[model samples]
Target: MATRIAPHEMPMIGRRELVCLIALMMSLSAMAIDGMLPALDEMARELGAANGNQRQLVVAVFLLANGVGTLFPGSLADRYGRRPVLLGTLAAFAACSIAVALVHSFEALLVIRALQGFSAAGLMVVPYAIIRDQFEGDAMARLMSLVGAVFIVVPVVAPSIGQGVLLIAGWRWIFLSLAGVSAIGALWLWLRLPETLHPEYRHEINVPIILRNMGAAFFNRAAVGYVLGTSLLIGAVFGYVNSAQQLIGEHFGAGTWFPVVFGATAAMMVLSNIVNSRIVETFGARRVSHAGVLLFMLVSMVQVWASYAHPGELAWFLPLMAANLGLLGFLGANFGSIAMQPFAHIAGAASSIQSFFRMFGAAVVGLVIGQAYDGTARPFAFALLICSVLALALVLFSEKGRLFRRLNGPVRQEAE
Candidate 1:
């Protein structure tokens, strides 16, 4: 188990309502990315994009900017407060979405997308620090799992939503819809969510202090190791998402059935998160995630063998792939809660620094995994095994040769 903070006053809303609201706020980024996918070709054609690769940069630039921009909000929130940063981010996101719909040139569109992505970073980073403020240990993991279970449904349904919009209206309506949704989310936050950060934890926004506290977070052995390890696991998951269409549609010949197959595999993840929330408290986070890694490695071995022996049918491949995705529910949130255990005092700065690394590092690793795909699933299968193995090693390092052990409370904070 990870360390727990002393009980702070609870929010006005109930636990389930807070989880739903947090999940909705976080879902904006996913909806922006996934829902716009079906309109890429049309966007490229209308805006006179130079080539297919350049057209794809609409999504790519936003992701790059989002990762880089994660460095700001949590640190800013550390000084200003969570409510203001969150509200400003939601407003900025809505403005950017509306701006994207009005852009006439490809260059302009990419620029707006990058800005939108940077703004969307707060929707993710602040919520993490918020949840950290309210809960820790298995309770934090449980909250994260439930939040994830809700947030994840966006990806499963977003493309279909986009496609439906395109069938009846112009591609720009997708952005308009995004704008409407974020505005509603902003309104909800303004009305209901209370400022959760403790006043004693608040401090100056000076760069030296921010840097110093972030250094304290990273220098802690248990915290930094789990952060890096979780990023490696995230890379493996992102790599699968990057290549899913090619693997499921082309290699397995799913054709028009691709969405159904993808949705089914993703649905398993939702189920696993639900299961994880139910059991993480009983088994403990470390034990649960370690078991997940072991099982993931086993499934990857079968995948590697199967890919090499036969190209495989959809029936054979889908279930194995689903099992791998499902296991992440056991790993991601638990690992995140564990990583944050040592940094309650500097939660914002530490969260910003760690999130920046996770976003940037996972994207780089995932790009390598996706670009290495060679028609067959051999590259992807090997990537799964390699990433999982390395992640396990990192976890072992963090645990200092221990596994399945529980610590009673947060690590003692080092001197500033």
Candidate 2:
């Protein structure tokens, strides 16, 4: 029998186990995206990609479908329960992985990849909902930061893992490996995760209720602002991801070094999350994130100047990229935590709506940036500058021009 527990109940596992479980669940999507980076060239050649840029559609389409899929899981999880919905999504994700391996054409593969992303959206949404269910404000942020600290390892090593798979077998084996991983995650979650959605908090899964809840999230000024800011920041990250391979491999002549550079930059994000976990509780999310966004804009400006001055120079570009990613790591967990703070009663819907717009909008911007790749880092650098400025503006507007004001709440001291 399933363990039925209230949303207010603590997680069944120990602290370390909880962090690992949450990180593993979230890593499903990252592994899917980052692991495919190394195989893009081989996959493109075999699948009849129309142009070098066209291969980017493989990543962009998955993100789009993942965003669209975010619209439903939150409401479903609210109505039914988190555990069941997550289990079903993980099963579908595994199935999609298998289907991807059997596909022949690029178009067919893209279709399956979209389905895979759609299924993976549950992993994206429900975990945040679960986090909100049990914690609030800085406590939640700290928990998320820790989860992110561990989760960031997936992206750091995923490209290298994909490269290893390429050395020994076809790219299809990559998806096969993902399937195995998803299956194991599903099994682990089923055995260990307790139900967190309290019965009293459950909402009806109807059109009217869903629309009303979504409107509530959209109209909440703080939630909307953070969501928009998070979207713009994510757009910049997507832009980088789409261009990194080309910039490093083609422009810098580092095909074999792509994974090393990417992994090193990803490590910066992990380090930032570790720092965030330590400081977010004492200084507050707003204070830390405000400083982060401003620093991000400044760093982006430097990147724009550097790109123009030293075109194709890895020495200048790599450090700047790491700094930008580090700032992003600061924004991600904080933004999500703040945006959902006011909507804890509707965490599922709020998380869904926030992530849908964030991922979907970012995918659109990233797609444009990816297609604009012209054997130079100028476009990528410029996109980062614009995205940072826009994000900072949204954040300012959200806070009513107030940068680091902490919201009124009694700080809860969480046990380690």
Give the top-scoring candidate (TM-score): 2
Score residue 238 of candidate 1 by CA lDDT.
Answer: 68
Tens-place lDDT digits, model 2, residues 1-416: 01122356666776678789989988989999999899999998998888888888889888889988999999999889999999999899989989988888999989998999889999989999988887788888888899999999998999999999989998999999999998898888989988888777788877887878887876677777889888888887887788778878889788899999999998999999999999998898999999999999999999999998999889998899999999988999999888877776788888888889888888888888888899999998899999889998898888898999987654322110
How big is the positional error of residue 162 in model 2, measured in Å on the Cα after superposition? 0.4
Tens-place lDDT digits, model 1, residues 1-416: 44345535667877888989999999999889878766776898999998544554676667768788889998899889898999999999999999999999999998999999899999888999998887778888888999999988887888778878987997899999999999899888889888888888887878888888888876678877778877787777667666665677678887656667877887788899999999988888888998998898899899888887777577667888889889988998888888877677788887888887777677677767766766778888898899888888888988997888877665565424
**Candidate closest to the true structure, highest lDDT:** 2
The lowest-lDDT stretch of 10 consecutive residues in candidate 2 is 407-416
Off by over 4 Å in 1: 1-10, 48-56, 414-416
C-alpha RMSD by candidate, in order: 2.2, 4.1
Model 1 TM-score relative to the real fold:
0.93
